[model samples]
Each structure stands twice: as structure tokens, then as C-alpha cells.
Target: MTRKEEVFERVEKSILDFDGDKAVEVAKEAINSGVEPVEVIERGVRKALETVGKKYETGELFIIHLAAAGEAANRAINEVLKPEIEKKGEEIHFTGKVLIGTVAGDIHEIGKTIVSAMLLASGFEVTDLGKDVPIETFVREVKEQNPDILGMSALLSTTIPVQKDVIEALQKEGLRDKVKVMVGGAPVTQEWAEEIGADAYGVDAVDAMKKARKLVGA
Candidate 1:
């Protein structure tokens, strides 16, 4: 096989093996070997997470496995791939900006963190507001940051209503149409997103990235 193919496989394998250190090593090696940052990310790290997601869906992998892979992928992209791109005199321009937070009453952050990493890797500027964020904070940030997209996540059925409240708050402030709204979490559904007037519902981190891209026409 070609050198590029070999390096790609090596990086991909490191993530699949859930070895964060090795993934970082391989990512740097790929960069030094003239592999493009985007190639290493899309072909290696993202592909590995996609597999991990599938394995989780099939019950072949536990939450720990997915978490480990997510951590490794985040390291590979942020610590290695992104720097390489910047070193190449690229400005790391983002196609869009997103403001994300976990709605009030729900403290779940794993999903939100992963989605932030993935969006960052995919070249979106993300401002994370942390977990159990108040609806007023969302409205405040939306108005202040003027982000291209606003993402709300909730891990509880009760907290899901907070997403609606935030949207309503945006509409009341006349800022609803200025940005696209995306919602997701374990209990969040596409119907719920629509019912809450969200422009998109991300089923997972990857889906969130895709929907964000579509939202910004990227």
C-alpha cells in the first residue's frame, strides 16, 4: 500500500484500539508525513468514532468504550491535527459559529462535550455554556455572541421543556430568526425539536455536525 494509506490506517487503528496516547502519536506522525489535517481527521478520527457509535448501537461496545474513543479522537484532532493545519499558514477559518449549552435542571455534559469537539474538528467555532445552564443565559449569549447556530441539550424529560422556553425567550427578544436552533440529548426527539420550533435535531455528535453544516450552508 501507499505511504498515505499506511499512515491513515495506523491513525485509524489507534482510535479503534481506544488508545489516546497512540492516537496522538499517530496523528502527529501523519502530519509529519505530509498527510493533510483534514484527511487525518475525516479518515481516521471521525471514522473511528463512527465505528464506535455503531458498536454502541449494536450493544457490542459499552459507554466506556465510546467515551474512550471520543477522548482519543478529541486529543488527536485538537492536539495534533488542528495545530498542523495552523502551522501550514492556514487561519483555521470556521464556516460557522455555534453556541451550545445543556438546558437547566440537566447536568449531563458528555454528549455536549463530544459534540463540541466534533464541531470544532469540523471547523466550526463553538462556544460551550456548560451544563444546567439557565434559559436566560442562553438568550443572553445568543444575543451577545450572535452565533450562526444555537444548540441546546437536555438529558431529562423535564429539562426538555427548557429548550422550548429558551426558544420562546429568543422569539420574545426578536433574536429567534437571526440564528438556527438545534436541539438534542438522550430524551430529545426530532418531533420534539420541531414542536419546539428547533430548526434541526441532532441524533448524535456526528448528526449534529452534519446538521450544523447544513444550517450554515457549508
Candidate 2:
């Protein structure tokens, strides 16, 4: 294989193995060697996550593995994509800026972390509000961040309605029309997202990228 392909394979393997620093090194080297962040993420990060997900479903890997891989890939992508992302220049088209957070009462962040990395790969500037975000925090972030998309994530069925609460808060603040809302979670569905008035539903990190971009018109 070519050097770029080798880097892709190495980075992919590092994420599957949950080797955070190794992934960071491979991703950074891919950049230093002139490989685009988008290419590396599509060919490596997402590819690796797909494998990890399959393994998880089959019990070859567990939730611990999934969480570890997600965190590792997030760090690696952030490190490697920073330079190229900064150099995006002023005139480029973007999928959109996204404000991402896990809703209140949901401390699990694996899904949100993976979603953030994939969005970054797809060229969306993401403001991650971390886990267990309150409705007020989401509204305040929208007012301050002015992002084109508000991405709410929850891992628990009980916490899913917090996304609806955030939507209500945004609606009450008259900011609902200003930005699109996207929802995702273990128990979330398109019907639920629609019921909550979300612009899109993300079934996974890859689906999130496409759905968010489509909603934001990018």
C-alpha cells in the first residue's frame, strides 16, 4: 500500500485498539505528510469505529471498549485536524457550525464524543458543551454561540426528553427559528425527534453527519 494508505490503516487500527496516543501520532503524521483531515477521518476514524461497533454488537468487545475507542478517536481527531481546520480560509463552504451537548441526567458521553469527531470530520465547527447539559445551558449557548445547528444527545431513555425540554426552552426564547435542532440517542427515533420539533434525527455518528448537514443546507 501507499504511505497515505498505510497511515490510514495504522490510524484505524489504533482506534480499534483504543490506543489514544498512537492514533494521535498517526493522525498528526498523516497531516504533516499532507493528508487531509477529512480523508483520514473517513478512511480511518469512522472506519475504525465501524469495526468497534460490530465487535461490540457481537460481544467481541464491550461497552468499555466502545467508550475507550470513542474517546481515543476524539482526542486523535482533534489533535490531527486542528491545523487543517484552522487553515480552512475565510471563503470556504461549511456543512455548518454545531453546538453539541448531552442533555441533563445523562452522564454517558461515548455517543456524543463519537458524534463530535464525525461532525468535525465532515467540516462542521462544533462547540461541545460536554455531558449532562441543562436546558438553560443549551439556550444560552445558542444565543452566545450562534451556531447553525443545535445537536442534543442522550444515552438514556429517561434523559431523552431533556432534548425536548431544550427545544421548548429555545422555542420560548424565540430562538427556535434561528437554528436547527438535531436529536440522537439510544432510545431516540425519527418520530420522536419530529414530535419534539427537531429538524433531524441522528441514528449514529455517520448518520448524524449527513442529517445535520442536510438540515443546515450544506
Candidate 3:
């Protein structure tokens, strides 16, 4: 394999092994060897997470494995590549800008964390508003950030209505047409997404990446 290809392989392996330090080492090596940070994310980290997502879907990998892989990928990006890009004053060619959060009353964050990592690897600039985010916070962020997409997660059945409430808030503020809305979580369904006027319903992190790409025409 070519040198960059070899580095990409090692990066992918480091993530699959859930070795954040190794992933960071490989990321530094990639930067030193003249690989663009975005290229590492797209060809290396993203490819690895795609496999992990498939394994999870087939029941070969569980939630813990997913979380581990996500953590490793995030460390490689946040710890290594990000700083390098900022140092070089390089403009990251992001696929799109996404604002994501877990709805109010739901402290569940595992799913949102995974999706954020996957989205970052997929080349989207993601701003994670974190768990238990209030409806007004969602609306205000959309207004301020003007992101290409707004994603909401609600793991609990009772908290699911908060997703709809946020969408309604966006409409009330007349910002509904400014950005696409995506909703997901354990209790979220396609029917629910449609009923709430969501632009897309993500079944999983992989699906979320795909739908986000389509939503932004990336």
C-alpha cells in the first residue's frame, strides 16, 4: 500500500482496537506524513466507525464497543487533527454544520455521543449541546448558529415529546425553514418524525450520517 494508505489502515485499526492513544499516535503520524486532517477523518476514522456500526446492527458488537470506538475516534480528532488544522489556519471543508442535543428531561447521552462522533468522522462540523437540553436552548442555538441541520435525541418515551416541542418552537420563531431538523433515539420512529415535521429520522449513528449528508446535499 502507499504510505498514506498504510497510515489510514493503522488509524482504522487503532479505532477498531479501541486504543485512543494509538489513534492519536497514528493521527500525528498522518499529519507529519502530509495527510490532510480531513482526509484522515474521512478515509480512516469514518471507515472504521462504519464497520463498527454494522457490527452493532448485526449484534456482533454491543453498545460498549460502539462507545469505545466513538471515544477513540473523538480523541484522535479532538486531540490531534483539530489542533493541527487550527495551527495551520486551515479551513476545514466540512460536509455541513450540525447542531445536536438530547431533549430535556432525558439524561441519556450514549446514543447522542456516538452520533456526534460519527458525524464528525463523516466530515460534518457538529456542535453537541449535550443531554437534558431545554427546548428554548435548541431554538436559540438554531437562531444563533444557523446550522445546516438541527438534530435532537430522546431516549425515553416520555421525553420524546420534547423533540416535537422543539420543532414547534422553531416554527413559532419563524426559523423552521432556515435549517433541516433530524430526530432520533430509542423511542423515536419514522412516524413520529413525520408527525413532528422532522426532515429525517435516524435509526442509528450510521443512518444519521447518511441522512445528514442527504439533508445538506453533501
For 165-189, candidate 3 gives per-residue lDDT tens digits of 9989999999999999999999899
How many pairs of residues collide in each model?
0, 0, 0
Q: What TM-score against the true fold does each predicted structure earn?
A: 0.64, 0.62, 0.74
Could you say which candidate leads in lDDT? Answer: 3
TM-score order of candidates, top first:
3, 1, 2
What's model 1's TM-score? Answer: 0.64
lDDT of 1 by residue, 80-180 (tens): 88788777876444568899999999999889987886675555667789999998999999989899999999998878899999999999999999999
**Roughly what TM-score does model 3 have, to 2 decimal places?**
0.74
lDDT, model 2, position 41: 78
lDDT of model number 3:
0.89
The Cα error of candidate 2 at residue 84, in Å, is 1.7
Q: Where does model 3 exceed 4 Å of error?
A: 1-6, 32-34, 50-63, 93-96, 111-125, 155-158, 172-174, 186-191, 203-210
- Local error of candidate 1 at residue 106 (angstroms): 3.4
Candidate 1 Cα outliers beyond 4 Å, as residue runs: 57-59, 87-99, 109-129, 134-149, 155-161, 168-175, 184-195, 200-218
User: Deviation in angstroms for 37 in model 3?
Assistant: 2.4
